[model samples]
Target: MSGRFAELHLDQVQRAFGDTVALKGMDLTIKGGEFVALLGPSGCGKSTALNCLAGLLPLTGGRITLDGKRIDDLPPEKRGFGMVFQNYALFPHMSVRRNIGFGLSMRRTGKAELNRRVDEAVRLVQLEEHQHKFPAQLSGGQQQRVAIARAIVLEPPLVLMDEPLSNLDAALRLEMRTEIRRLHQSLGLTTVYVTHDQEEALALADRLVVLRLGEVQQVGSPEEVYAHPVNRYVAGFMGYRNMIPVTVGSQEGEHATVHTEAGVKLVGVKREELGSEAVAAVRPEDFAVVTEIGANTIEAVVEIVEYHGREQAVEARLRDGTQLHVRTNSRLAPGDTITLKVPAERVLVFA
Candidate 1:
């Protein structure tokens, strides 16, 4: 292997099982030392794409290359990629030290060199005291750390993780996200992570490749994808609420005037040119509970108030029975009538 790291380029990669297509024409490029995530819901083919890249599954069409050299034909064992599985697939009978050194042992490295590499990896993962324990003896988090160590000890140029934190509790998952970020920064490894969890992908990935029904829906940074999605599917998945259908009445530059089927007029911003038929979407926090109604204001009766300590999630319904969720600090009751104003720029119009 060369001393320089390699960028991965997937050119129209496709995977299929007979008539059932799992991945269709996936094209993505990951910069060297960058963290890329294959993000989507279950059955969206994110895992299939990851499997193809890891050489666990062959592509049905197109090519996968690293720094311009073809890699799709290589076997999983020859891919020189470290993998952290969801279950932390460590050998049950092996001690942590042995498990971490297994890859190097397979390559037949000298005893002194193997011990040095494994020791360094163990320290990097902060599992010094648990080095002698077996897989069953360590906490889920620690076992995962060992799995990560095993993957990184070889110091592979690329790292592949398949829903690595799914088995951990919520708190532990958050903790491991931080740990994974730290490792990525320190090691400067090109990483591809597969996850169905939106929060984890947003928190960990430098860039996101959102897939749906065997196709890429969007590819962007977390902020870009969350703030402005290209379509209704992506908007809904990115935490956008108020996905009601509306008819566009007029447009002034990026601003749009539209009305719901109930004749409720709404104003929002459109990133792309929108047709007469479009979807009006706004995030929960984008609305404010006003005391009075005016232009672009929605009158709603509070239905459910959920306390979230720092903020409250208020569910309300309009006169026309359109339900909305708003996050705010306003003290609200189920029977109270409130006015919500959505700023034009904070709203999204997706065609």
Candidate 2:
């Protein structure tokens, strides 16, 4: 892929509807041919950002650029970008081949060329077996595959998908996620995907931009965002279940002693400058049930134990009344006394 077509730049983009702000000074730069995901909860303006890039929605402020050229004023049709929606907007009456050929037909391509492209698209999505079937004859996953084939058949440089797997069942969603990743790697098309699903973001994105309330929270690779979250919001969003209020008792060397309200002294490393009071977040998997009490150990009463097949999630309340969750293979009954030892390196402190 050419370097020029692989670059995407969003410069302080903002969008508003009357008095309600949907996006606020958002800035991002996506590499050409990279798969990037915009991840956030509902009403967080992720869809608005994708719309702005596609020229389907006009920005209330800021600019959008592709390959260093401003394209915010361009119309959606003229943007030369393919979009796949959650609904798999296929024409019910059209066959798979016809649906994939629709874009080429609209462009007045020769019949021979259209046929070749349509066949190629069908093969690309492995829908050749159902090429003659209409949308009604196909399963949900097959219909979505056809939708994706239609989007890519145009050979657009960029593809935008808005929760394309939302309609599928859990098993099918997992299958489609791998398929999309494979397709991205094979096609080398620059992609911007939007989803509220954290697992989807982690699985599909080369990097992710996490948004909250119309503002950019953090932008990083999955490992970076998950391992070193910037704040409490990002930490909680990344599945850190234990977030307890702590008073910054002392700072020594690289470790900080945080005193929880329940009088438990938890040791953690501070990545940011947190003053006298802060919040400490610990991942469930980071805590281990131990018989001995150590520096970062907390004595708690087991409130509940949930068996999730692969692992057991133990919910316990510390002496300070703070709820802590631990994931272990060792089974524990409810109301059992336990000492949960949190590794200092696994504990994250946020202001």
Candidate 3:
């Protein structure tokens, strides 16, 4: 297959509902056979972007191109894009086989071709046992599988999924995530998935597009976005919990000394441009309980200990009232005075 068939491009895409702007000149280019996820909080216009790509919504400004052809003016049905919604939206009266064949039928495909495609899709989802069952008779996860089968039955060039697994329970969600990833790998389809769940995006996306208030915040691979966030918002969103205000005491060599409100001096490499005041971000896992003397060790009183299967999270407070969260395997009793070490490499300095 030609790579152009899977190519999708957006340039300066903008959408407005009357005076309220939903998307503000967004630009993105998704490569063929790549799984790109639009990840952000609610009302971030990720869905709007998807709608525009599917030709379900009109753009207020900018252009959308697919396979080197302008498609912003095309109708949804003419776009040849498969969409799986949060709600399965399956026909209660139609059997799973019939539902999967619905799209092919609409395209006036031959009965043999329709049946062949339906069978293929049903088997792909491993729903052959339920092929004769109606949507009402299937579990939430099964219903979602049918929805996916229906979307892929026609073999559209691009697939757009909007939180397709959100309705499932936790365990089922994980199962479906693995299934979807496997399916994408098998089909090599260019996919644009939208979800507010960070874990889902982190687990499934080859590239993540982070948005906030309809604007693109960052676009990178999951590891890049998680390990090196551009700002405090992105840092906190990626599970960097320990955020403390710090004043740059001095910059020497490759490291800078930051003074916290508790009068504790921390040595960390400055990742962001230095300012008089800044916020230091560090993940809980980056902190360790110090039994030996360390350069960035801080005296803390353990307030609470949370046991999380593999590790323990210690909630502590410094002498000058600075709250600290430390993660360590060493079990520390509550109210015990201990020292925690913040490693310089794991620290993120952001303004």
Residue 23 miss distance in model 3 (angstroms): 1.6
CA lDDT scores, all candidates in order: 0.90, 0.89, 0.87
Which candidate ranks first by lDDT, i.e. highest?
1
Provide the global lDDT of candidate 1 against the true structure: 0.90
Q: Where does candidate 1 stray beyond 4 Å?
A: 1-3
Output the better candidate (1/3) by lDDT: 1
Give per-residue CA lDDT, model 3, range 129-189, as digits (tens).
9999999999999999999988877778888999898899999999999999999999988
55-140: candidate 1 lDDT, tens digit per residue: 99999999998888998999988888888988888999999999999999999999999999999999999999999999999999
- Cα lDDT tens digits, model 2, 15-97, are 99999999999999988888999999999999999999888999999998887888899898888788898899999889888
Give the Cα RMSD of candidate 2: 1.7
Number of clashes found in candidate 3: 0
Query: Per-candidate TM vs. native?
Result: 0.96, 0.96, 0.94
TM-score of 2: 0.96
Question: Alpha-carbon error at 284 in model 1, in Å?
Answer: 0.7
In model 2, the Cα lDDT at residue 158 comes to: 86
Which candidate would rank higher by TM-score, 2 or 3? 2
Worst 10 residues of 1 by lDDT: 1-10
